[model samples]
Target: MDTLTSTSANTWPIISNIIGWTYFLSWSCSFYPQTILNFKRKSVQGLSIDFLYYNVFGFLCYSIFNLAFFFSEDVQDEYRRRHQDSDNLVRANDVLFAVHAFLISFLTLSQTFIFKSDQKLSVTAKTFLLTFIVFILTAIGAVFTEYIKWIDVLYFLSYIKLLISFIKYIPQLWMNYRRKSTIGWSIHNILLDLSGGILSVAQLVLDAAISGDWSGITGDPVKFGLGFVAIVFDLLFMSQHYIFYRERYDFYLAVDDSERQALLPTEQS
Candidate 1:
């Protein structure tokens, strides 16, 4: 059965590769909407500062994890030894996506300094920032002391990324609620994020199904959980933009005198 499943999984590489790259494109493209929006408006006024910081940091850790796992044979061998797996689950597209995401997230963070914006990271975000720094340092110390392998550090970093991704949306959601607007925060970003997230989860499930190894999904749920959390948050963001705060967003960005007048009177009240 294992041999049969392995052969089946080998045959599925082409299809899985296609789906993997599709999600990569979806996720990589998702970053551009907000980047372009910031440039177009010449401001990051309505964008959440905390979101940018958390996103960049999360992707930084994720990039390290993915790149190490993909390129470091040591990590791969350790992974297989740890999991007793024959196939290497790390894909080139995964590494590319993570690196690209980190670069893009960093680019957005740069805009916060370059663009017109008075917003600063909130107290909660600051705490998280410090925690991430300490976590990385501690992991490095463990690696130096030979208490943990580099592969173990990479695994820890990946898990940290998952946690960061899961919580990163909260500040943005709260910011939008407080401001009652999603102006500088592009709705297109949310839509693309939702698509990417859904596709990511689909890819994982497809890979697991083909390999007949439910272990990755059942045993290692970080990636799956992050994807699921992103989808949920994206829906909430959609609601904020299209339902809950729609009128406020429209009114806030309504520059034309006629357009401003066309907004619901309740917005003015």
Candidate 2:
């Protein structure tokens, strides 16, 4: 059972912190444009409710996972015991990013309630949410019944978040396709998210370089996969905004220019 040579905390502490916080800010900032857009339109029209539901729930799980792994000695010990004493990869920025992302996602959900919009959680979203509820409850039962450790509960929570990451973006992409426009949705959000995803993957590479082992990535391929998925979706969104739906977007602003005026913020390609 080959694994990372040494994982008792990161060796490159300062450099790791810098990379961690940079991506933290980038990923945390990714929610702003959508928030601002919702305010500008006084609507969450093009924003998908399914996306928000998934986003909010996913981040909540992620937040718990990060917080527990980073802050809980019991969880940390259990994790190490399970993983042959491998240090948990969670960093301060990981906890901060997860908490901040959850807050932002929750704020966006609140906006959906305040604004004028007809979108409701899809049956699919509801089903997934309910399914996660069952998953979470079962994890709790396992923990209390001594079937699994608290750290295992944390991992299960993260797994739900991971599953949601793969599913969350689809609604937004489909909405853009159906409307043939990316107007109400902000492209800036995608750009910032793309930067975060790229940086996240880069950070993994940097860690591997310093450690002289790629096992950090290979060991938990889900982390790498999540970054890759985000990057792929961000690129697809870039295409939808800049190429596929440019005409529709331009026409939207052209028609609404009189009303939207300066309220509709513009972004660069």
Residue 189 lDDT in model 2? 93
Q: What do the candidate models score in CA lDDT, each in turn?
A: 0.80, 0.79
Q: Count the backbone clashes (under 3 Å) in each candidate.
A: 0, 0
Clashes of 2: 0
Worst 10 residues of 1 by lDDT: 1-10
lDDT of 2 by residue, 193-213 (tens): 988888788777666656555
Q: What is the TM-score (0 to 1) of candidate 1? A: 0.87
| Candidate 2, poorest ten consecutive residues by summed lDDT | 260-269
lDDT, candidate 2, equals 0.79
Each candidate's TM vs. the true structure? 0.87, 0.86
The deviation in Å at residue 244 for candidate 1 is 1.0
Superposed by TM-score, candidate 1 places the C-alpha of residue 96 at a distance from the truth, in angstroms, of 0.8
